[model samples]
Target: MTSSEPTSTRRRLRRLWLPLAIGLVQVAGSYGAYRGQLERREPDALMVVLALIGPIALYWLRQRPVLVLTATTISTLTFMLLQYPYGPVILSFVISVFSAVIAGHRLAGWVAAAALYFGHVLGRIALGINEDGIYQSLAVGAWFVVMVIVAELVRNGRERSAAVARTRKQEELRRAGEERLRIAQELHDVVAHHISLINVQAGVALHLVDRQPEQAGTALAAIKEASKEALVELRSIVGVLRQSDESAPRQPVPGLERLEHLLSRTSGAGLEVYKTSAGLPHALPTSVDRAAFRIIQESLTNVVRHSGATKVGVHLQYGGTFFELWVDDDGNGVPETVVEGNGLVGMRERATALGGTMTTTRSPSGGFRVTAHFPLSAEDERDPD
Candidate 1:
């Protein structure tokens, strides 16, 4: 076993030692008290035997409370029958009560306590003991009541502590979930956007190589720059998933301001593209910016892969309540046979995580369109950036 395992086991053993020691000590002390009674010449052999048995049995009371308690009852009754003072054996009664509480049988414990109390009172009465003295009986009843109250209070305090620990654990889980979502958003933004641009630029370089060799070389150089930048950003974003000593990159991440460069790369790819925006460029939540960027990039990717049409359109509009994004391809719309893939599922998760919505639908003019509606305010509150 590992060193940690032994240390943990040792800790557990240490916790049990004190309680076990207390029980054994109490039993030994009771046995000594009984022997003292025997030396004083008031020795009832039955009382001595009963006293010895009661304390010894109490040591195992928690593990076998019912059996130990049965012994306790028999021993205490034997003492009383032989006309012995019950005061010296009172510790055995308290121990029995403690055992019952630990066993989660409070009613049985109380019943045992009551029986002990009444047995003493009734026996004393029968033996012509003073009936005017009820103080002793009252004292016995009070002691039992106090033990039960203390046991119940201890049980409740432990329950409250457990509830607090559970709440703290749930709060920790919620914070972790939020952190994962923030990282996912950053990955979709930084990696996907730059990768889409690189892919487009690479395609442009390939198409122009034969007709315009010099121009093809310029496109190739741009492609190299875009790919290298994309790889660096991708590595940085992926690093968030690692459990390492290094810190996350604190570089200023791209937002709407970088959209122009992103779109320029696509245009350089020789794809006809148009972009229109209505609102003044405003700072958006990192999640919203990431989501908006992803939706546009994925839509363009779908256009490149599936659509035969030459033109694509991207529209961004920000209102007081929400920010709207629309990407449309004037190509053959998505086929009914097209199965939803991980990319689509990822897009949906991103939208839902931000408390936003996205939909893919066929446009009226025989084209495919993607619409993403994001609640900018709701997202900004939790945006890590």
Candidate 2:
């Protein structure tokens, strides 16, 4: 069975103590006052016993409300019969009505209320006590109704507050995810171009180093310049996420025109990449361009981190309505358990948020493959009437 939570424990303690403490103090004080009224004569032993029992019954009010109320009513009625005061008994009845309201049992509370009122009528009539009759009963009944309504309203308001808190938490998570994607796009753009130039120059220096030492020196200088540029661009790319002002120059992020640059960066990372495109377009929406760029970047990052392969392949197809990206590495393949690193999970989240699908599988030659398909733009997604 589920145990009581902390809030419930506190509520239970409050419910148990309030009725017992208040009822006992009032009953004792009333008994003392009545005893003083008959000081010259000996007090009625039975009236004193009934007064004590009425308060003692309150200890069980929360655990057994009906039984405790029944015991209280019997003792209070007996005290009235013996000509003791009715005020203490009337106070106990009011407490019982309030307890029943908060306890969520309207039918039971109403029945208990009716019984207490009838007992009051009997005690008053039997002892011929001249006091306000119908007015007193109606006042007590109204108190019960008010307490029940307040309890219900409090319960509903708390539920509404909790629901609002849950929705706000979900919105926060979604916004955080979007921020991460934006940062990823910025990093991809900042690094791709300079790395492209680095790879081109590196290849030229390596090819010309022996043929002509003089020309090779110039080519090697170009390689050094290219590598330094690549590092500066990389630092600036990473600095976007930092609150620093050591800004480096930035270049426009490669769009469709810069797919070659993307390929160059992969080659500079010492991984040969082959890319094929079909039905290529001139440009894409910024969001789609950013997403596509990040997906390819993450795929290559994973290859560098996990895929022990010398060569990778990238394939892109633009169908106007949608586009596809495929990256495959001839690594020893993903592990059988398919546990995902943060980069892989981020790529999947991006694809899913854009209403795209990403699939990862092991290729036949012990390699890893990733494919993502995304819509071209929001305008492309709207249905025509």
By TM-score, who's the top model here? 1
lDDT of 1 at 383: 53
Writing each residue's lDDT as its tens digit, candidate 1 over 1-385 gives: 9999999898767656644554455445545655555533244555556667777676566678777676777677656656554345656656666767755777777677777767767876787766436786797679768887786676667768889999999999999898887676556555655565567667777787888878888777777877776777777767766755487665546556666766766666557888998886566777678677776776776676667657888899877667888888789887766687655666777788778888888876678888888876644544536
Clash pairs of candidate 1?
Answer: none
Off by over 4 Å in 2: 1-122, 130-143, 166-260, 270-274, 280-288, 302-312, 328-346, 361-368, 375-385
TM-score, candidate 2, is: 0.48
Model 2 poorest ten-residue lDDT run: 376-385
| Global lDDT of model 2 | 0.67
Tens-digit lDDT track for model 2 on 130-215?
56568886786686566556655664676688889999999999987777776765555445434544555566677777776677
Kindly give the stretch of ten consecutive residues in candidate 1 with the minimal lDDT sum.
36-45
Q: Rate the local accuracy (lDDT) of all candidates.
A: 0.69, 0.67
lDDT of 1 at 331: 91
Error of model 2, residue 130, in angstroms? 5.8
lDDT at 77, model 1: 64
